[model samples]
Target chain A: MIWLVWRQHRKQALFALAALAALAALVVPTGLTMRGAFADLGLPDCVRTLGKAGPANNETCLTAFQQFNDEYQGFLLVGILFLVLPLLVGLFWGAPLVAREVEHGTHRLVWTQGVSRRQWALAKFGLVGAATLVIAVGYGLGIGWWLGPLNSAGQRNRFDPLFFDMQGAVPVGYTLFAVALGILVGTVWPRVLPAMAGTLVGFLGLRVVLATLARPRYLPAETLTFPIQGTAVAPRETASDWVLASGVRNASGELVVRGGSIECPPNATGPGAAGCGTGLGVEPGAYNWQLYQPADRFWLFQGIETGIFVALAVLLVYLAVRRIRRIA
Target chain B: METALETDQLGKRYGNTWALRDCSLHLPAGRIAALVGPNGAGKSTLLHMAVGLLRPDAGTVRVFGETPYDNTAALAEIGFVAQDTPLYRDFTAGELVTMGGKLNRRWDGTLARTRLAQLGIPPDKPVGKLSGGQRAQVALALALAKRPRLLLLDEPVASLDPLARREFLQALMGSVAESGTTVLLSSHLLADLERVCDYLIVLHGARVRLVGPVEDLVAEHRQLVGPRHGDDPIPGVASVVRASHTDRQSTLLVRTDGPIGDTSWAAHEVTLEDVILGYLADGDRPTSNEAWGVPA
Candidate 1:
C-alpha cells in the first residue's frame, strides 16, 4: 500500500519540492540583502528608542527608517504566494488524491485488492497529510526568517493577519485543514474538478471568516484610553497590537462615533467650534479609547488559531474516513 | 459442489428506485457462470455486491461463506474486474503488475510479466497509451496474478472490438483452464458467454428470472407449434415462457420436465439463446396481452 501511494503521488511530491526550492531561491537573497541594510542603516537604535523621547527619534534616524522601508517593503508581496500555497496543496495533492481515482474508476481496481478500503484511505491520507505538514512548516519558517528585520524594526506587525498566517505553527494547521477538507469533499463528490473548486471556495471562505470574525475574539481584548489630541495616534504604542476597535466617548461615556473625528453642534460659537475642530478630546472628560489584542498575545493567538484549524482538520478526516467506508 | 459465491435475499437501492431487489443465487466453485441480463437489469449491481464494492440494503452477500463487505480475508479470495476494466492510466503495465504484487498477499508477479510479454504489450508504455484491448488484457493479468479463488468480471468485453473481445475471452479461458478458478462474468450479449460458460443466471427487471446449468436449462425448454384455436391450457407443459400467434397457427416457447404428450402439437428443440430470450421476455408486457395466442 505504501509503495502504491508513493508511486501514485510521486509527481505531486516532486512538484511540491520544486516549489519549495523556488520559494527558498526567492527569499534567501532578499532576506540577506534586507538584513545587511538593517545593520548598515543603524535602525536597531531607532527601534530601541521607540515610544520614548530621545535622539533616535531625530530627523536622521527617521529618514533612515523611511529609506529602509522604501527599499524592502516590496518584498512583502511575495507573501501572497505563501498565502495560496495551502490552497494549491488542497487542489492538486488532496482533492485529486481520491477524486481522480474515483473519477477514473481506478478505485475499483485498488479497493478490490487484499487490503481493505480503510487501509487504502488511511495510507493515502497519512502520506499526503505528512507531506502537507512538512511543506507548510518549511514555508512558515522561511517567511519568518525573511520578515525578521522588518518585524523587529516595527515596519511590519507580526500580529497582522498577513504576517501572522505565514509566521508560526498556524500555517501547518491551515494546510492540514485544507487538505483534509479537499479529501472530504472529494470522497463525497467523487469528481476532481468539482472537488477542487469546492475545496478552493471552502478553504478561502473559512479563512476569511476566521481571520476577520473569530480571530479578534479569541481572547478578550485589552482596552486603553488616552487623551485625544489633534495629532494622529502614535505608531509605536500600537506597533504589533491588533487593534479591534477605536472610538471617541462622550463625558457620560457614551460612544459618540467610531474613529477620532468629532462633529460640533450647529449652534456652537467660535471657541466651542474651535475646540471641536481639534478632534475628539474637545469635549470635557472625553478621550480616545482602543480595544486591541496586545503584542504579547501573538504566540497565544497562534496557539488558539492553530488549535482550532487542527481540530477541524481532524474532524474532517474522521468524516472522510466514515464517508469512504459507506461509498458505493 | 462447494459454493464460491452466495447471496441470500440481497437487495440494493439508489434513491427511490431499486437497482437490484430480491437477488439470491449461488455460484458453485470451478464453474464459469455467466450472469446474462439487459442494461439496467442489475448485473453490475450484483457483481459489485459480490466484490464488496456495494453493500446490500437487505440480506447478505458472501464470498466463500464470509461477508465480502470490508472483509480483508474475503476480499483476498475474490478478484473483480469492474465494468470498463478500470486501471491507472499513467502507470505502465509492468508498474501495475508490480503494484498488484505489493497490494496482494498472493500475487504471481512472474505470471503477470510473462503473460504481458507474450501478449506483445510494451512494458514501459503507459496504460493510457495502450490500445483498449491491451488495457483490458493488462487489467485481466493484474486480476489473474492475485490467484483469487473466485474471479468476478462485469461486462469485461462489452466495450471491446470483435477481435479484442474474442482474444480477451480466449485469454480468460486459458487462465481458467490452468487454475480451475470459479468465474462469474456478466454481459448483456448472450453470444459472449454462450461458448464459454457452463452455468447460467438470467437476470431481468432487477430480478433473477432463471438459473441452472446451461445444458439442463436448454434441455428443459422447447418450442411448441399447434392450431390457434385450442384448449386454454396445454398438457404436459410446465409453463409457457412466451407465445405468438397467426390466424391459422400458434407458436409457443414452453418449459417442461416430460415429453409433450399431445400428438397434434409439434415439439422442437430450443437453443440456449431461445430459452434466455424467453425468460427475458417474461413480465415485459401489460397483463391484458398475456393470454395465449394473443399475437404478442
Candidate 2:
C-alpha cells in the first residue's frame, strides 16, 4: 500500500520539493545580503536608537535605515507569497489527490484491489499530508529567516496579522488545515476542477476569517489608558502592540467614535466648535482609549492559532475518511 | 455446488427512479454466468453491488455467503473489471503490476508479467499509449493475478473490435479453465456472451426476468406458430413473452415447463439471442407483430 501511494504521488512530492528548492534558492542569497548590510552598515545600532527607542535625530542612522528598507522591497512580496502558498497546495496537491481519481474512474480500479477503502485513504492521507507539512515548514523557515532582521529591528510588527501567518509554526498548521480541507472538498464534490475551485475559495475564506476575526480574541487583549493631553493624541505605548480599537468615551461613558476624530452639531459655531465640544479636546483622563494584544503575547497567539487549525485538520481528516467509506 | 454470489432482494434507486429492484439471483460456484440486460436494465448496478462497489438500498448482497461491505476477507475473494477498465495513464504496465503486488496479499506477479508478455504488451509502455484492447488485457491481468474465487466483469469487450473481443474472451476462458473461478459477465448484447456462458440471468425494468441454465432456458421456452388467436390466452401456453399475429397466422414466443402436446401448433427451438430479445422486448408493451418469425 505504501509503495502504491508513493508511485501515485512521487511526481507531486518531487514537484513540491523542487518548488521549495526554488524558493530557497531565491531567499538564501537575499537573506545573506540583508544580514551583511545589517552588520556592515551598523544598522543594528542605528535601529536601536532611530527605531522605536527614541526620536529620529541622527541623520546618518536614519539614512541607513531608509536604505535597508528600500533594498528589501521584495521581502514584502515574499511575505505575500508565503501567505498564498498554502492555498496553492490545497488547490493543486490536495484537491486533485482524490478528485482526479474519481473524475477518471480510477478510484474504482484502486478501491477494487485487495486493499480496503480505509487502507487506501490512510495511505494517501499519510503520504500527502506529511509532504504538505514539510513543504510548509520549509517555506516558513526560509521566509521567516529572511525577515528576521526586519522583524527584530522594528521595521515590521511581530504581532501584525499580515506578518503573523507567514511566521513560525502557524504556517505549517495552516498548510495541514488547507490540505485537509482540500481533501474533504474533493471527496465531497468528486470533480477535479470544482474541487480545486472549492478548495481555493474555502481555504481563502477560512484564512480571512481566522486572521481578521478569530486571532484578536485568542487571548483577552490588554488595554492601556492615557490622559488626553493637548490637541494631539499621544503615540501608542509600543510599536509592537496591536491596536485593535481606540475610541473616545462620551460624558455618558459610551464610546462616541474613533479617538482622533470629533464630530460637532450643525448649529454649533465659533471657537467652541474648534475646541472641546467639536474638535480635539484637552480634558486630562476624561476619555482614554485602548490597544490590544501586545508583542509579548506573540508566541501564545501562535500556539493558540496553530492548535485551533491542527484540531480542525484532524477533524477534517476523520470526516474525509468517513466520506470515502460512504462512497458507492 | 456452493453458491459463489447471491443477492436477497437487492435494490438501488437513483433519485426518483429505481435502477435495480428486488433483483435476487444466485450463481453456483465454478460456472460461467452471463448477466444479460439492455441498457439501463441494472446489470452494472447488480454487478457493482455484488462486488461491494455499490450499496443496496433495499436488501442484502453476499459473496461466497458473506456480506462484502467493509469486510476485507470477503472483498479479497472477488475481483472486478469496471466498464471502462480504468488505469493510471502515467504508470508503465510494469509499475502497475508492481503496484498490484504491493497492494494485494496474494498477488501473482509472475502470472501478471507472463500474461502481459503473452498479450504482446511491453512492460515499460504506459497505459495511455496502449490500444483499448491492450488496456483491457492489462485490467484483466491485474484482476486474474489476484486469483480471486469469483470474477465479475462489466462489458469488458464493449469497446473492442470483433477479433479483439474474441481474443479477450479467449484469454478469459484460458484463465477460467486453469482456476475454475466462478464468473459473472455483464453485457447488453447476448450475442457477445452466447459462446462463453453456460448460466444466464436476464434482467429488464430493474427486475429479474429469467434465471436458469442457458440450455434449460432455451429448451424450456419454445416458439409456437398457429392460427391467429386475437389476444386470447391459449391452452398449454404458459406465458407469452412476445407475439406477432397476422390476419391468418400467429407466432408466439412462450415459456412453459410441460411438453407441447397440441397437434395444431408447431414448436421451434429458441436461440439465446431470441430468448434475451423476447424478454427485453416484453418489457415494453408486447406487440402481436413483434415475434421473431412475423414481419413488422
Candidate 3:
C-alpha cells in the first residue's frame, strides 16, 4: 500500500525535496561566511556571544543571525509543504483514497473484487504514510548542514527569539501531524474545499486550544518536586519535577514559546504509547530548580509530542478505515 | 452445493434506511447473472457486500462458498469491475497492469495485452485520457487478466454512450461465454441485461422482487387480450397487474404459466421491456411459471 501511495505522490515528494535542496544551497554560503567572520574576530575565538548593548550593532547582528536561523529552521517552507500542499494534493493524492470513486460511483467495482475493506484501507494508509515520511526525512536531512554551524557556535544568547528557537524540529514534527490529519479529512469529508478548510480550521483550532489551556499545567517545574537525577527512569517511583518548554506554532503561523520554567505533575492515566515521560505534567508544587538545562526539557518535550502526534495519527487512520468500511 | 456466490438473508442499511433486505440469492458456477435495478436500489451495496468491501449489517455473504472478507485465498478467485469503470487516475494503463500483475498470483499478462490490443486501448495511454468506453475496456482487460473464478461488475456501462454500452456488454458476454466464469453484474438498463444475461434478479427497495431464468419468466408471462364487459375467470394465470379498454375491447397484463382459461380474452406474448417494467413499476412477484407482461 505504501508503495502505491509513494508512486501516486512521488512527483510532489520529489518537488518538495528539490525545494529543500535549493534552500540548502542558497543558505550554505551564508553559514560558511558566518563561520569566517567568527574566525576573523579572533577575540575569545568563536565563543557564543552576548552582543554589545548598542541599538545599531544589535539590529545588524540580529538581522544577520535571523537570516541564518530562517534557513536552519525551514518551518515556513516545510510547514506549508505539510499543511497546504497536502490539501491540494489530497485533491489528487487523497481523492482517490475513496472520493473520486464515490463521486463517480465507481467504488462498487473495486468493492466487489473480494478484497476486504480493512485490507483496502490498510493499503491506502500504507501508501500515503510512506510518502509523508519520505518528505519529512528529506526536510530533516537537507537542513542539517545549515543548523550544524549554529550548534557548533555553542550559542547561548537566549534573547534573540529567532527562527531556530521555535520553528526547528517542532515544525517538522507538526507538519507530519498535519499531513496525517489531511489524509483522514480527505477520505472522510471527501469534497476538496470543504475537506481542506475543515482540516485547516480543525487542526489549528485544536492545537491552539490545547496549547492555551494545557501549556502551563504540562511542565513539571511548576509541581516543585525536587530534581531527582534520572533515577533509573522508572515510573511508580514517585518521580520528581520536570519542565515543559514548548516551541509552538501559533494561529498566525508564527512560532512562539508559551511557558517559562514550570513544574511537573503526576498523572495516573498517562500517554497510551509509553515513553519519554508523557505522564509528567506540571502545577504549583513543592520543589525548586537549581540549574535546569533546556536540552533535557527538549528531549522530554519531543518525546511526548512525538507520542501524542503519532497516537493522533494512528487514531485518524483508524477512523478513516471505519468510514471507508461504511462507505459502501 | 458449492455455489460460486451466495447470500443468506443479506441486508445492508445506511443508518435507518435499508439499502437491501431479505436478499437471499445463490449463483452456481458458470452462470451469467444480471442484477437489474433502478437507481438507489441497493445493487451496488449488494455487490460490495458480495465482494467483502462492505460488511452486511445482518446475515452473511460468501464467494465460492467461503467468506470473502479476510479470506485471501477465497478472494483470489474473484475479480471485480467496479461501477464507473474506476482505475487509479495517476497510473498509465501499462503501469496499472504491471501493478495488478505483480499483486495477483494468477495473472495472465499475455492475455491482458492481447485483449487491450484487440479492444484498441493503448496500454501506454493514461486512463484519464481515454474515452469512457475505452476506459471501460481497459478495466475489463485488467479484471479478465486476473483469471478469476467469479467476476463481479457494478454498473460498468453506466458512463458509456448507448452504442458503447452495447459494445462493452457484448465483450463482457463473450468473455463469460468463452471462459465459463460465474458472473454477476448490476445495471439500470434491463434491455442490455435481457440481451446478455441468462439469469435475472430484479432489485427494488433492498428486496429481491423477482429472480429466475429470463426465458422461463418471459415464456410464462402473457398479456391477455379480452373484452371489457366480462369479469372472466382465468386458469393458470395467477394475477392481473393492469387492465384497460376502449369501448368494447379490453387489454390486460396478466401472469400465467400455461394455457389461459379466460374465453373472452386472447393471450399474447409479452415483450422483455414490459416484463421488466412490471418489476420496476412495483407489481406482483413473478413465480417460476407465472408470466404477467404487457406487449407494447
DockQ of each: 0.81, 0.67, 0.30
Instruction: Specify the highest-TM-score model's number.
Output: 1
Worst 10 residues of 3 chain B by lDDT: B287-296
lDDT by residue (tens digit), candidate 2, A1-328: 8888888888888888888888888889988988998788787776555424443356776677677778775587667766888888888888988889988888888888878998889988998898888788888777778877777555566677778888888888889998899899989999999998898888888889989988899888887654443423344332467778887765555665575533233344447334444444333235556757887788889889988999999999899999997676
Using DockQ as the measure, what is the rank order of every candidate, best first? 1, 2, 3
In candidate 3, how many clashes are counted? 26
User: What residue pairs are clashing in model 2?
Assistant: B244-B288
lDDT digits (tens) for residues A1-328 of candidate 3: 3455466667866876676577567656765765564444442222233222322334544455455455444433442343343234334344345565565554554454435557766776776666666655555444444444454332322111222223235444545566567667766876656666666776677666654554334454332223222222212101111223432222343333343322233433336743323244322222222322233354455456556666777787777777776665
The lDDT-based order of candidates, best leading, equals 1, 2, 3
lDDT by candidate, in order shown: 0.86, 0.83, 0.64
The reply for model 1, stretches above 4 Å from the true place, is A52-56, A229-238, A261-281, B229-231, B282-296
TM-score of chain A of each: 0.90, 0.85, 0.57
List fnat per candidate, in order.
Answer: 0.94, 0.72, 0.43
Q: Tens digit of lDDT per residue, candidate 1, span A1-328?
A: 8899899989989989998998899889989999999989998777666555543347777788789888887777767567888788888887887888889999899999998898988888998899899999898788888888888665677888788888788888899999999999999899999999999999999999999999999999998776544433343432577777888776777886686434344334345445553443346656667788988899999999999999999999999989888776
Indicate the worst ten consecutive residues by lDDT in candidate 2 chain A.
A229-238
lDDT of 1 by residue, B1-296 (tens): 89999989999999988888998888889999999988999999998899998889988998999998888899889988988999999999989998998899988999999999999999999999999999999999999999989999989999999999999999999998899999999997788788899999999888988888999999999999988835477778888888888999999999996888888889999889998988887554566655665765
Worst 10 residues of 2 chain B by lDDT: B282-291
TM-score of 3: 0.75
Stretch of 10 with least lDDT, candidate 1 chain B? B282-291
Q: Pick the candidate with the highest DockQ.
A: 1
